[model samples]
Target: MSTRPHLLYLAWGFPPAAKSCVYRKLATANSFARAGWDVTVVTLTEDAWIREQGVDRSLLALVDPRIRVVRLPLSREDIETDIRRFSEDRALRPRTWLKRHYQQNVSHFPEATFGGWRDELVASVRRVYDERPADLLLTSGVPYTFFAPALDLFERNGLPYVLDYRDAWAIDILRDRPAFRPDSPAGLYEARLISHATEAWFVNGAIRDAYADIYPDRAQDFHVVRNGSDVAIGTDKIPMRQPGPDEPLTFGYLGTVSFSAGLTRAVCEGWRIAREANDVLRRSRLEFRGHMGVGANRGASAQAVAIAEYAKHGVSYGGPVAKADTAAVYEAWDALLLILPGGRYVTSGKVYDYVSTGLPIMSVHEWDHAAAEILSDYPLWVRNDGVEAEDVAEAFLQATKVVQGATVEDRLTARRHAEQYERYAQLRPAVERLTTRFAPGLDHVEPVGDRAPKTGEDVHRETSVPGPHAKGERVVLALTSPPSEAVRRSVALLRESGAHVELIGPDSVLEELRGLADEVITLQRATAPVKVSPSTSVTRFTPRWASVVARNLGRRHIIGPYVRVVGRSAGWWLSARRSPPAMQALKDATVLASLDDSATYLIWNASRLNTRAPARAGIGATLEELGLTRI
Candidate 1:
């Protein structure tokens, strides 16, 4: 047998998932392989990813050929949007069937949707371990179910493993709240998993602190392994473009357009307002290049609809950009729009990519975002205080000025600032530390051949020429029901700002608010409740009793119905589906402001429709959650 130390990495969202976590997964595997360890990565199959988030074949190219990747036949049932794939029972009552499926899964494993994969994952790890005993096992998790297999391997063979939490399990990032109570099953599982883990890696200091606070004893074991940019794959040679006075500045947003609808609207409206206020902004274009949404909605999400509607206002969606084409995409843009949601817990993977580009960055997120910490020293960063249209508009103007005034020296300064955050730089030390501490024999092994040059190095140079800037103000669409005082004030404010505001509501309401808005659209109220399939329903206590009795009597027939009832209740509680007109308003609105609870709820639902854990909140609470005091 070879004397090389073996490492088995378990990452559910590895290559081809096209998910946000794939970059870190790719980097970790490659880092281990280069460190002279025999690396084996276990991940879900491409077909499984296709049925869920879809696959990106381009990502496969980024994986090091020397590292072995084993594809598991695992897929998520919840994200399956194809109705044709549903069984007869599931088709009859989709919500109920799904609930029961989740219940069955969680009963076996702590993770709800992915709990069912416990056996397969355990078997896969065991098989790999039997083939060649692994010196180390590293598991990255969103589906914390990976812990079960890792724990199994440890208990069975005394193998040491590290827990890599890309996102925390017990903490909710969006709400900044504890996702599970300390006494909950998930909480218990996390405690047990961490108790035996050699080390726990987090994406940022904030997340590490969160875990540290929860488990004070294991605080020293936690480490921050930030998601750094891959210079070899992208961000190698810096390209600088300076727009002339008459030329239109191209502001580009790269990565998935998966933020809240309110955030998206704010950025679009800010661009609109900036264009109206500044000649330079009016002639500019903001292009979004990434996967629009997940599952069946894909590019046809509300975000895509809004982008299509704003086509006249210099907003365009160029679809998903390939991993190899990332450099080319950055070269095409004059500046970058960094739009992300969540407060301290959310440090997007794209921020490193943006910083490495050495291009001017216009941030469209809360001031409290972790990305702010990283970009604090960046030379050409234009940050917004809040998500309000006016603040965002001001940021757009500032970014335009920065891009116009950018010099070669300024670009070089920005690139130099990002040098510390390259993928290899971040991973090499972490891998070296792990080897030295745990597998000391592997410490002397150098990385297999010279790796690609880091960014800011003189290699594969490209010259960029200045482009022309385009100009014009954007149109605004406003939707109101009874026209409350808040709505009236908001409408008046938009009109005073010189926006071409259009109103859509009841005829009487529109007539009452006619002078406040530029155009009025009258909508008729529905006489009957809108009947949508998979209708929301309440679960009765009888089901709980029935479940208990069924368990005692060993009657699976009773168990299925009880589980379905639980699922139906959960579906009703979590569903954020909206009416046609409300969706239309979201699609057309340059900026969405809600005065009343109903309007706010509608907008909030639309914004969080695709989110994994969509929460219901009033306008004030939703705005507060987004780090905005007002819109």
Candidate 2:
């Protein structure tokens, strides 16, 4: 094996996955590769990618050949494809089963769905370390689940590690508050994890502040790693294309639509209001492009729902603006909507592309979003923090005016503002910082992992029989509509799988189920139970507003009571066709039944207790039984 320092890079959504994380992950990987380090990237397999934000191999164009990429055989059971693969459990009770499953996943780790990935990720890292002794272990996360793996190595042996906290896990930057309680298990976990890092990287300064407050002593280690734009992706062969007189202006947004579905809804609502308030907006066409969600739920999500709702007003959904095709998407639009999260703290990767495009920009993000720091220099931009229909409408109005009336001087000014955020400029410094400044210990500490000479791409595959019946695994009971059955059953499984599920209600109850449940209430219009069909699959593409379907079932616990807040915050998630809790709950019950009820329902059973889920229950045995094994 070569003696050059080997960097074991852990990025869950590397190039091949085509996830929004791909651009950052690719940039980070390539930076290391160019820095004279042997890079081995560990990510989920292609099959899993198919189920979430379907893959685009072209995204891998920028990846360095020197970088070795490994794919594990893992598939997110949450976003499974092939309806034939659905267990009877999913087909019968989708929402309840999914909630139970989500809970179980969180039980493994604070992050739902990703929590179960801890073991696989740790094992994979161990194998990678064993095959080639890496001089440094670089870790990046949002699926904060990656932290578990990174920590796993730390606890076991001594090796230097760098933590790229792309987005804070426990801190809700948008709300500018701790995502969970300080004394809560999550809070404690984050505190412990942050305590061990040699260095921490955040996309924006706001995030750094939040971390400093969390770990006052290690404040200096927490560094800023802005989500800058890619020079390769930002460069346009065709420069600014002006709209013809009388041709309605086209406004565009392109990026990974993951996380906050609420953001999408707010933007959509703003789009709807603008069309109604101004003839100019009504006449203009809003073109949204980029990966709209991932997995089997692609192309159809709350974001899609917003597009559909505003389709009448000329807002259309054009799926996936490729990294190579980013220029095309930007070129197609007359203006840009910089929709982001976390006031002033969250500088998204899309901002680099937006400013680089030199298009007139409109800010649909938080009034204090970090991108504002980048765009404040641009003369032709409008920002609104209220997220009110009126503000979005006004932004729409301003963008329309810029697209139709801005002078050459204006366009030149916008382009100039984008010059600074080139991906190269942002990533190179980071590569150097971690290389020179990072070390592992209580402070600048070394990591822990089994030490042995290891090299090459090492992706471990688990043993899971795939087929119609999963090769005779015990058949699970499933029920359609009114999550009472599904939720109740899921609780049983969660308790069985190891979550401390406590039944809070009676065995049976009836209530109406409705669309996009704002709160965990009874099913709206629970007239008749639906029959099981063989056509459901975990990999199926659902509509954007799938919460409407889940509402038909009584189960509605995964999401918070604030639908408007979540909907506005989750715009990216909606567009990406990701399995938002708003939709996943429904999908869970749907898939479980399709597979002959081979699922565990928690919320449904808990409803029998006529009580809410125990917020105190942390990681326990209920995990496996809750379908967490599938996520």
Local distance difference test values of all predictions, in order: 0.70, 0.59
Q: Deviation in angstroms for 426 in model 1?
A: 1.1
lDDT minimum window of 10 residues, candidate 2: 613-622
Question: Tens-digit lDDT track for model 2 on 444-465?
Answer: 2122111112211121112232
Judged by whole-model lDDT over C-alpha atoms, candidate 2 comes out at 0.59
- Model 1 CA lDDT for position 266: 77
| Candidate of highest lDDT | 1
Q: Give a tens-digit lDDT track for model 1, residues 38-115.
A: 888988888787655456776787787888888888887766543334454654355567799999999989788899
lDDT of 1: 0.70
Indicate which candidate wins on TM-score: 1
